[model samples]
Target chain A: MPNPDAGGHWGEFGGRFVPEALIAALDELEAAHTAALADPAFMSELDALGREYGNLPSPLYLAERLSEEAGVEVWLKREDLNHTGAHKIRNVLGQALLTRRMGKTRIIAETGAGQHGVASATAAAYFGLECTVYMGEEDTRRQALNVARMRLLGAEVVPVTTGSRTLKDAMNEALREWVASVEHTHYLIGSVGGPHPFPMLVRDYCRGIGDEARAQFLERTGALPDVVAACVGGGSNAMGIFTAFLDDASVKLYGFEAGGDGYGTGRHAATITAGQIGVLHGARTFVLQDEDGQTIESHSISAGLDYPGVGPEHAHLAASGRAAYEPVDDAEAMAALEKLARTEGIICAIESAHGLAGALRLAKSLEPGARVLVNLSGRGDKDMGNVVEYFDFADRKGQQG
Target chain B: MRAEAAFATTRAEGRAALVGYLPAGFPTLADSIKAVDIMIDHGADLIELGLPYSDPVMDGPAIQRAADQALAAGFRTRQVFEVTEAVAGRVPILVMTYWNLVERYGVDRFARDFKAAGGAGLITPDLIPDEAGEWIAASDEHDLDRVFLVAPSSTEERIASTVAACRGFVYAQSVMGVTGARAATSAAAPELVRRTRAHTDLPVGVGLGVRSGDQAAEIAAYGDAVIVGSAIVNCYLDSEDVPAGHQRLAALTADLAAGVRR
Candidate 1:
């Protein structure tokens, strides 16, 4: 197991590779991050915000039904219960506070499924700063409800039409906007990807989940779980939980990637499970790219899990064998979603179902008493349409002809 | 102001002649030409006619928007050559561009047509030095000065190698970042100029974030020539019409040139 304060370089996976236009912004972020690490005043400010605004220290609930079904003891760290209904608010609040400290007046963010946009808008509203979000035209059309949510939250949503019309296009649009407004606007990147300080900073803010979970788990179970499971999209949620348990050699960490159809079909966003080491976005990470280094289109039933690249820190974790990555196909994840909805009445997002599915499979292979902790990354409220459509539940109920 | 004599003199000066940059087809090609004429009129010595690419990574938003507008108006490689040819060697023209447009245009034909159009130099902002040797040789055959940029992050050995292969004055990026106009010049520009001077006697002109007359004057104290780009492009954005834009630019350049001379 590696040390926690290891400068966010999982091994050689995380480093800054941004355009020259962003050097100043990145440098300022790095400097502020360094200062915040040592300054108790900055730390306490974030702590207060987490408690008052973000509803920090979310509970680690023992999933008695899930454990009984899987024949293993299972627990969940409920990050989906956060203020923004996902883990994204944790990072956004921290970054928004830092933006105020830097004297910046504007905030810009790019979103795929609009979770990050909602979180960023929430932060901007709290801080009284102007906010703008760039989302791909395709995503905007598919996630119309989230777009309306952002608008209602007082953040302008600009639809990007370039590239593949997905998260990649939104990112390119955001980069263009950042280059133009580099002076007074801070780009609030959503996940543990992009350049150096971003992955490090987002991970630092979200690490509270793992820290609290570790202490709570010890108090309840008398020891850490044998395995920790979390779904890896941009890997923020997984890294947040894994960071605290990285040094616990007895605990095995598993990250489940979206295997759209399956790794064999080659249409998945399972970068760690199916990709080679390469560069994308800004960091050197495992990416689904061709020989010429062009990014390939990825597929997933879940829009949030359709990105072609994973966080650089996840790449490092995969490389060092500190973490094991497995892919959960569309069918399997969908099944897990239904299983949780029926068993526990907790409708989990299709993305979070990847972790749920992985936990079930791992439980089947392990001793009946072995404990597993799954980071239930988000709720299924945003994904109800996809679940209903994929399962044809309304048609079976005779609600549709 | 003929390009042949300017190239010959530039070679004799033991330094690359300064090629001032102004976005082509910006405001309008008609007024863009006047801005070019104004640069040549005020001892610009050489000129870089920027053929705006859709994705200009090395450029700031102001220049990027200018390029986007130029592109939106159907500004292609052939139009860039036609515009330069219209100048008729009043000053040497270098087509600064992204490689994708050049690849689409066919590099050999693009090189030949560019030189035949009274152009005397070429600068590819995105070309890495390791991959530029073949193009450098091709440009030499066509008798075009190949300009290159040196940054703060470039290693000393890489700088020497690139400078030795380079034909025109080395473009000294004043800051560690991309092309933009700033309220003030970068504090690092002086040290960067000093470091560039140590390796090659090529007249180093500092660019990126140079916006005002006072900053140009300060840079001119150390640099052999000061390169102002984003400021001039932003001036075009400020005006409603092309001729009005060119008139504004001419006045601004004259003031900046005077400060540089002082």
Candidate 2:
């Protein structure tokens, strides 16, 4: 299979489709990216930052119980253990370093579940750059702890009230703020969406996870995993892992999208699974839009997975059949969340649980000796309350024999 | 004297032409159409009708606010074309818009409808020449001129490439940023104009900050066209009523057009 990034597009997707306000910024980023790719000094600086600040080379752990239960060997890429407790720190560190290199004084970001906000705040604190995070009012209320955490790190958290009062609205507010302050501020987008150079740049920064994981998996198993699975929201983690393995024909890539109830219910974030190819968030990608082309509301138990669009690379991967996408329902993901906690003693984010659930289903259909790798995208610490409340886990635990 | 005659005479003297920009339906759709007729009646050889977007990222606060107001007043893509259709090709009409709206409206349909509405061209401020392949075919199919912008920061290589891809004329941004009226034009604009002229035979029109008659004259002296956008947009904002707004825009357009020939 050809590398989708060959045409500077991810399979006829992911071009710089932005307003003129961002042209200069994107151009500057493109120049810096070109320089950084060629300059060993720049690479070394980013390497040092990743090592010291982002806690690079996150572990790849074999899930013994999960493997036994599924009758297949399962390995987990432990991005959940990274600093700030998620994979977001990887991109944030890279961008914050780039911001400093560009001599920008401030950073602005948008958050849905506040993982990106926390990561941005952490990076801002490390770099001593003033940071402002725009979060939808509903998200601020739901993720109050992360909001406090950002404020504690000296970053301002502004509640955005527009559109649907969610991640999309927050993103719009951040874009508006960036437009207003393009001279000295960098808008640190959280995921692998948005205009050119961003999707490519963010993917490059986060690809370290897959790079390290592939090597680690090969070292441990003496062969590549039959399938690599990760949950896809804006598809940052999935793209991170899938990109490195794109050229490996034998390795199957799977992206699990959130199916709130079911794809037929028209209330899921199963963009690649149910959406048609359309332009959204500055790139041509799969979007869950109505027949009239109006973007429809998407729902998920996890706030992070409630976006109506998927990253462009994911769309390309799915279209080319290099990657398979499946939607995981709320119940299935919650069940996987609990199962992982009890079996592996690792509490995974509800978003990541979708991957685990997908892996379990895939394991059932595969050969008994098949090996699979699931990207444990984040820890479930941020979602403990919701998990407990939604599943009645407290009562269920007491009722357990 | 007719505005077309003034422009023709200036072109015969090897002088640049003059283009004017007005937000489609600035004070009202009727007022905006009246302003367009007035500008063409006075001197605007080519007119850029800015399709107001909810988020006009490239525009400064004034233009952004004006766009927001226009959108609130039920301005839309179809309505802009409707206004163009009413004008009936008295002059070339260029639709200036952000790329998202263009993508959403379907580039092929937009190009077809725009041409069918008597529009001569389209100026996608955000669309880079390198990424314009898909829309280029659509524009060609519809026989609409695809105008590209060249900024001060554009490299020589990019300038040549963009100029080659562009039809009609190349919009030369006078400054680094977006559309807004400025107290004075950039000192580097004339040199930029000269540099752009060396690269392409296409007419180069300077935009982004031309607000006064003096600035228009200064730019027209060096370039193939001088574009004044925000100053004209401000004229409508300053008026208390639609009639007053149209009258103000007409008088301002005549004054600016006269300045180019002086």
Winning model by DockQ:
2
Residue A269 displacement in candidate 2 (angstroms): 3.3
Once model 1 is optimally superposed onto the true structure by TM-score, how far is the C-alpha of residue A282 displaced, in angstroms? Answer: 2.0
lDDT of 1 by residue, A350-374 (tens): 8889988988988899998899999
Q: Which ten residues in a row have the lowest lDDT in candidate 1 chain A?
A: A1-10
Q: How accurate locally is residue A258 in candidate 2, as Cα lDDT from 0 to 100? A: 98
Candidate 2 positional error at A222, Å: 3.5
Tens digit of per-residue lDDT, candidate 2, span A170-244? 876787677557779998989988887778888888898889999998898888989999999999999888877
Query: Model 1, which residues run further than 4 Å from truth?
Result: A1-10, A395-401, B1-262
- Score candidate 2 by DockQ: 0.20
- Among incorrect, acceptable, medium and high, the docking class of model 1 is incorrect
**Model 2 alpha-carbon miss at residue A261, Å:** 5.4
lDDT to native, each model: 0.78, 0.82
